[model samples]
Structures are given as structure tokens and as C-alpha cells.
Target: MTTTPNPTLIYPPKPSILFTNIHFYISHKPFTSSSSPKSNSFTIKCSGNASSDPKNSDGGLKNLLSGIVDERVDELLNREENRVLLDGLDKATQRVEIAKRELAQIEQQELENKKMKEYINQLEIRAAEIEECQKELLEARTLVDEAERSLEVEIEDKNSTMTETEREEMYKNKERFESVKAASVSAIVGTLAGLPISLTQAANTSQLILPSVITLISCALFGVTFRYAVRRDLDNFQLKTGTSAAFAFVKGLATLGGGPPMELEVGSISSHAFTGAVYISENLLIFLFAAVGLDFCIKLRILSPFPIETDVSTTKVD
Candidate 1:
């Protein structure tokens, strides 16, 4: 095998450079020495023969083959063609900076327009909410009006008195009540006076239908008679006790000026009516005897009171 010798390596001299800062500025920030990012220093680095070194033929030969010298590079910088190319490059850089600034302004305008559109949408939503609230308010007002009308109609019906058509039924009930009451009184009086068992008592003992018949008959007569009263007596009483109280309460609501009295007459009326009815039902014969006793006292002039007016025309509006 044969070995070949390695060629000797040669190195050219390294270049020297000079820098001249054309426009350098110092910032006013405290204790900061930060340099600008843009390089404004003119570089004059070239492999030229201006070095003060010892003459060496081998080094000169290496530099000849390496590159151009510093003098030639300076001459190229001053050439007309190179100067025009540099001017063109500088103009292009300026145009690029203007384009970047315009792009930033356009982005800012687009962001502002987007924010305005969002604000407009919010305003529209608020308007819609306000309109909905107004509609609800109008609906509530309409409902309140309807309620007032219904309440007024109910008040008129409750405060009004009996009509002419109801008087015929009232008279019939009055006739039935008078007949039954008279018979009951007579039967009780006779029994208490030691008279013989009457037909009514006899029927009640034999068949249990007499008492039931009397109860139903009295209820039918009194129920009809009490619906519309010509008088506030036992035969004609306020059956709708709660409703009458409610009517009076509604009338007494206006208490500022001359409103009606706040006294609840229904309590007194209901106490007398239901209590009297219950007392009679406990023992009809005893109730009749009591009535006879009261009548005897009154007829003997031992008891006298104010006269009661029961005619339909005698009713007062208040």
C-alpha cells in the first residue's frame, strides 16, 4: 500500500474594522444604558493591505487569493451604480415602515367598529326588555279594570232589595207559617190546660210521620219566607248571614268621610234567628206554651213596646 503526503494549510490575515456612529441617542430613563435596536454604525471591515505588519511573501500570496482589499471596497461604495442601488433600498425600507403603520391603524378601526356593534346590540336588547315590561303593565291594568267591574256588579246585586215578583211567594209562605204556628200554639195550650189528647198528638204517637211532616213543612215555609223579608221577624230573617255581613263591610270600606257604621248587625241577627229556631226544635210543645204565656202577658196590658212596621214601603235604604 502507498501513502500520499497531506498538503500544507495556509491562512490569510484577519480583517480589521472601524465603526462610526452616524446618529446615536441617549435615553433619559434612570440608570438604563440600553442601546437602540437599529444599527446606525457605518462598518468599514475589509481585508485590505493597510496593515502595518512585517512583509511576508507567503502571507501576501494567501491574501491575494482570498478576497478584495479595503481600498477597493471603499471605491465600490462610492461608485454611481452602487450609490443608486443603496438609495433604492432605503426608499423600499421607508415604504415598508409606512405600510406597517397603515396596517396597525386599520386593525384599530376594525376593533372599534366591533365594539360599537356589540354596544348597539345591547341597546336593542334593553329596548326589548322595556317594551315587554310595558306590555305586562298594560295587561295588569286591564285585569284590574275587569276585577273592579265584576266587584261593582256583585255589590249592586247584594245591596238591592226584593223585587215585586218575589212578593207572591212571600205571601204564600206567610199564610202557611201563620196557619201552622196557630195550630201549634193551640195544641200546646190545650195540652197544658189538661185537655184530652188532640188529633195532632194522637197521630204523632201512632205514626212517627207527624213530627217529620211538621219539620219539613216549617222549613219549606220559612226558607221561602226568609229569602226576601218585608220584616225582620222570626218568619222572615236574614238567611245569608255571612253574605249580609260581607255586604255591610264592603259598604263601610270608605271610612274617610261619611261612611256607614262599622257595627256588624249580622252577629245579632244570626244569634236571634238560629237560636230561636233551635229552641223551638228542641220541644215544639214547650215553645208553643211559652208563646202562649207571652201572649197572655201582652194582652193583659202588663207588657207594651214600640209598634213594629213590617210593610214593604217601610224599609229604609241605609
Candidate 2:
């Protein structure tokens, strides 16, 4: 029996091919008695261009390696273990970027704070300067007020001086009238007192006229002096008495030296010393009468008091 020759199965040799931009996916399983051999074998899948030229093979091989590397990287990323590791790496990178951004923001905030602090310091300095300037202004204002007050006082003093001068000029006529009134009162008193005595002792009318005129003139002079001496005194007995006695003594001296001679009377003293005593005593009586009348007139507001006392009081008030 010619058995059919066992079929001679021969495999042809594969030609070398260069691949460019090719991707390959490979898988394998452990061989086991229950599994098919095909299931345990490695598998390869390829895509992209293939060439047999040696010159073109290098570039294609390089492209194939590059594509294979990219495919392997994609596979690794898809796998569970490798994907977890890549995810951890990506999260760590994101954290690093976020940290950098936060650091930049913190630095900017610190710079802004520094600028704000500087501005505040400048404002404080300006406020202090303003306070100092205000104090200086207040002091200047106080000085100006004092100057104005002093000027006002000076002007018032000048005005018051002018007023005093005008018052003195106006009162001159009044002073003269007072003098005339006092002198006339004294002359009348003297003539009345001396006429009787002169008539009693005179040798003739000629002697009477001389003694009477002399007495009248002397008493008039005394009255003017008395009015000034006791200008406003109405009730001072001592001043009035002293003034009368002084006038009487002066009149007696004048009569003894140059007065008209008196004729002797019956049953009367005739010595020169006795005659002098009579002259003094008679003048004293005449002065007493004049003083009483003048004092009465002063009390009745017939004359003004001296102006010197009023002027001194007004000056004290100013």
C-alpha cells in the first residue's frame, strides 16, 4: 500500500522589511496543557509604511522605534499600576505649580504692605508739622492782640491830655470872677469897720480918707489870700483863726511904719505903743468879719472850689 506521503509542509523565509511610524501591540499568556498553543503565543500588530531598501531602512527603523516607544508609553499609561504612578506624578506637579503661584501672591502682598506703611509714616510727619505751625500762629495772634491793646491805651491817653488842656483854658474866666467877688466882699467889710474908728480918732476928713483907703486896700489883699488858703474849708475853726491873726499882725506893722497919725481923744491912751495895740486889735476885728462872710458865701455855693484836687482824682482813675 503506497501510503500518501506525509505532506511535506515547508515554510518560506520572510523578507526583511523596514517599518516607519509603525505601532505594535503584543500580548502573551503562560502555556498550559488545557490552553491552545496559539493562545499562549506572542502576537504583534503593526501599522504604517514598509520598505526593503537598505538606505531607506535606517530612517524607517528609526521612525518605527520612535512610534514603538510612543505606543509603549500609551500602553503603560492605560495599565492599572503604571496609570496610578503617572496620576501621582501629575498631581504632584500640579501641587508644585499651585505652591509657586501662592508664593508669588504672598510676595506681592508683602510689597503692598511695605508701601502702605511708608505712606502712613509720611502722613504722620505732615500732621506733626501742621500742629507745630498752628501753635506758632496762635502765639503770633496773641502778640498782635497785645500790640493793639497798647496802641488803644496810648490813643486814649493823648485824647485825655487834650481834654485837660481845653478844660484849663475854659475855667480861666471863672477863676477871675471868684477872685473879684472875694476881693469886693473883703473891701466892703474893711471900709465899714475902719470908717467908724477913723472918724472917732481922725484930726480931719483928710486923715480919715487916707487911713480908710489904706485899710480897705490891705483887707482886700488879705481876702484873696484867705480864699486860696482855705479854699474848701467851711468848718475848720483853727485855719480861719490863724488866717485872721496873720492879717491883723501885718496890718498893725503897716500902720506903725506909714499909716496916718490918729488924734488923741479924751480919757484914752495916747502912747505910740498903745496906738499900735489899737491898730492890731481893730484890724483883727475887721478880718474876723470878712472871714465869716467869705466862709458863708463858700458854703452857699457862691464860688467854686480849687481845680487841683479834682484834677488829681481824675488822673488816678485813668
Cα-based lDDT for every prediction: 0.47, 0.73
Which ten-residue region of model 1 has the weakest summed lDDT? 248-257
Per-candidate TM equals 0.30, 0.43
Worst 10 contiguous positions by lDDT, candidate 2:
1-10
**In candidate 1, which residue pairs get closer than 3 Å at backbone N, Cα or C atoms, i.e. clash?**
48-70
Identify the runs in model 1 with alpha carbons over 4 angstroms from their true place. 1-68, 161-318
Residues 1-318, model 2: lDDT tens digits = 011222353432324332233334334322234444432233334443345466786776588678866976676567776667778999999999999999999999999999999999999999999999999999999999999999999977875776655655556666777887888888887778778878888998788888888888887887788888887766789998899989998888677767556558643435666778888898888888888877777778775555424565465445
Clashes of each: 1, 0
| Model 2: pairs clashing at backbone N, Cα or C within 3 Å | none
Question: What's model 1's overall lDDT?
Answer: 0.47
Which has the greatest lDDT?
2
lDDT of 1 by residue, 161-181 (tens): 556556545655655554455
Leading candidate by TM-score: 2
Model 2, C-alpha of 164: deviation from truth (Å): 3.5
